[model samples]
Target: MASNVSDPAGARRPVIGLTTYLERATQGVWDVRASFLPQQYFDAVTASGGVAVLLPPQPAAQAAASVVLDGLDGLILTGGLDVQPELYGAARHPLTDPARADRDEWELALLAGARERGIPVFGICRGLQLINVAYGGTLHQHLPEALGTERYKIGGGVFAENTVDVDASTKLAGLIGAGPYGVHSYHHQGVDRLGEGLVVTARTDDGLVQAFEAPGDDYLVAVQWHPEENSADRRLFLGLVAAADAYAVSHRGVSA
Candidate 1:
């Protein structure tokens, strides 16, 4: 465990856990060293006055979760490959590029454990989808086929901007404001059936679900956008880190 650092006012800084990915090849031999995530993720969290820690890919690895959860104030589920559909009782699509099943299982366990313990969580892109499926929800599998439109592209290009309508009265709306905001979209899968205790908080112009949140919770937010790609969009990390800071202050009696 790392030492807890106090802010200038003597409040303990929140520790934010960010998920990672595994590097696998089409052929044989998986190299563990190949795993990586962009540093902007850490920069975002740290910039928001939170300490960032990388949660390595260890699916079905509950021990890893326990270790990471301890001494951490929040969890951020970062983006990655498509989750294996079988975990959520669905068949894999032909286009599905399966991510690490073990890592998925571990993260799901981590999410369940975190919620039970009142830890704040921020899910982005694939992270959002994973959280939904873990809680008895399903995904579209392939957005283009499901939506019958190509207005949203999920691959191969620089980040593109799109608008997301915010649901007033939701934490997301409070953070980003009541009107539409430009967001970066880059996913083929989206929430098809919302999970229990979850509510849609934002959507694209085409009516695709862009974000959701756990009602009444201060920090369980999931969005299908890459805010880290655009730090100028400070609302994304600010909202999450602020909630996390509050959680830490309330539970641990430390100021953020």
Candidate 2:
């Protein structure tokens, strides 16, 4: 596989595709649109010398994944609605918010294809939960009921700060450094059982899962917070872009 080297003639920046959300308008119609991510997300990726592409919700998984995988150097699944429990062979919980079925299928397919092709992946908030479910893991659906903590809120208000203990040996620790840093939290669901090949690297003071990384091989990571909401937290995006750049240099574009 030839490396998809950014042609030096033109400032070739690695392209990263960010998953989007679907919204129902007042007109009583569901529209597929690219949700606004904090400006910090773009700044973070741009700071790392990567091009950020906002990916809109696609209707089909195979077609969507093909197009996304072809042009992207990496995939970043942004936070959004809850995932359908039916995806993992479980009944839908009464408290579980309606899932975005289309987004779920598309992202799961995208993540699976990325894994098979060695494409780098970064999962944030709902993205983390999606990765876990896509990889045979389950989510708590509603965090407060499962974890017994109202400390984390996801109601579109100002983000609340929380402490996350980092594992000294993990890549995440290397990125954010040791000790508990203030993280912005805004999610109602969390990983209940981890996906295969993923090891927890960070946890909340209350023992809730905060972050995880791919063990042994692969540049895959998922976090339960919105690092993009903080422009100051460039390390998270840098780490992801760096991994994608390395992977792009290694695998390039050999279609599977």
Candidate 3:
């Protein structure tokens, strides 16, 4: 076990545990169905001065998810498959892809655990949806039927560029700066009903829920856009690492 002491270099780097994708993937010399994630997330965390750790899904993962979070400084719910509508008490839409139940089950557990531990959490895309569901919220299963356009998602494995209007009074406005900001979006579902203690911090011209934060002020902020996709401005990742650093300093004077 690591000691409860700070190293000048190592201690400053907060350990951010990122959720991974349990799906089929192909790479250089190997192709297999397993736990994986796009490196963009890890890269963002690393570039922002944090050590990225993978939180892989396994049997009984959720049962002990909170315990695992105790060892982490921060958590990033990365973008992935659609969440199960049944979990949110809604029927699935025709164009909606089948929900990744295994991922959903494990992530919900992680969310419950993280919230219990008061871990700093940043959710991106699917991650945002999961956060909403975890708080007893409903989802707009398909945007096309709801909005009459696929503007939010360009499909064919591409992200659409859009603008967001920020709520000036929210904490998110302080981090990313407000008003008519450009963002990268690639989702067909969005928050249809408000979650417990969640405040809408940003949205698009179409009035879809673009960003939200739980009001307790514990570094809990999630955006429908992918900040990891934009490498240049990494205030979101920086914010998470900074909060994790503070969490480490205030908790046990140690960092994973």
Candidate maximizing TM-score: 3
Q: Write the per-residue lDDT of candidate 2 for residues 1-256, one digit (tens) a residue.
A: 3334454675556778888765543434655434556566677777877888877667778777876787778889888778899987888878888867888888888888888888889999999999998778888878889878777885667787888898898888889897787899988788898887789999987788899988766888889998988876688898888777777766774332
RMSD of each: 3.3, 3.7, 2.4
The candidate maximizing lDDT is 3
* TM-score of candidate 3 relative to the true fold: 0.92
Q: What does the lDDT read for residue 89 in candidate 1?
A: 88
The models' CA-based lDDT, in order, is 0.81, 0.80, 0.85
lDDT for each residue of candidate 3 in 1-256, tens digit (9 for 90 to 100): 3212334753467788899877777889988987798999999999988888898776787666856777787899999878888988887777778868778888888888877777789999999999999899998988998889899899898889999999997878988888888899999999999788899999998899999998875878999998888999899899888887777766645534
Q: Can you write out model 1's per-residue Cα lDDT over 135-183, one digit (the tens) per residue?
A: 7899888887998865556457667678899989988888888778888
* TM-score attained by model 1: 0.90
Model 1 off-target regions past 4 Å?
1-3, 7-11, 24-34
Question: The CA-based lDDT of model 3 is what?
Answer: 0.85
Model 2: pairs clashing at backbone N, Cα or C within 3 Å? none
Model 3 is weakest, by summed lDDT over 10 consecutive residues, at 1-10
Q: What ordering of candidates by TM-score runs from best to worst?
A: 3, 1, 2
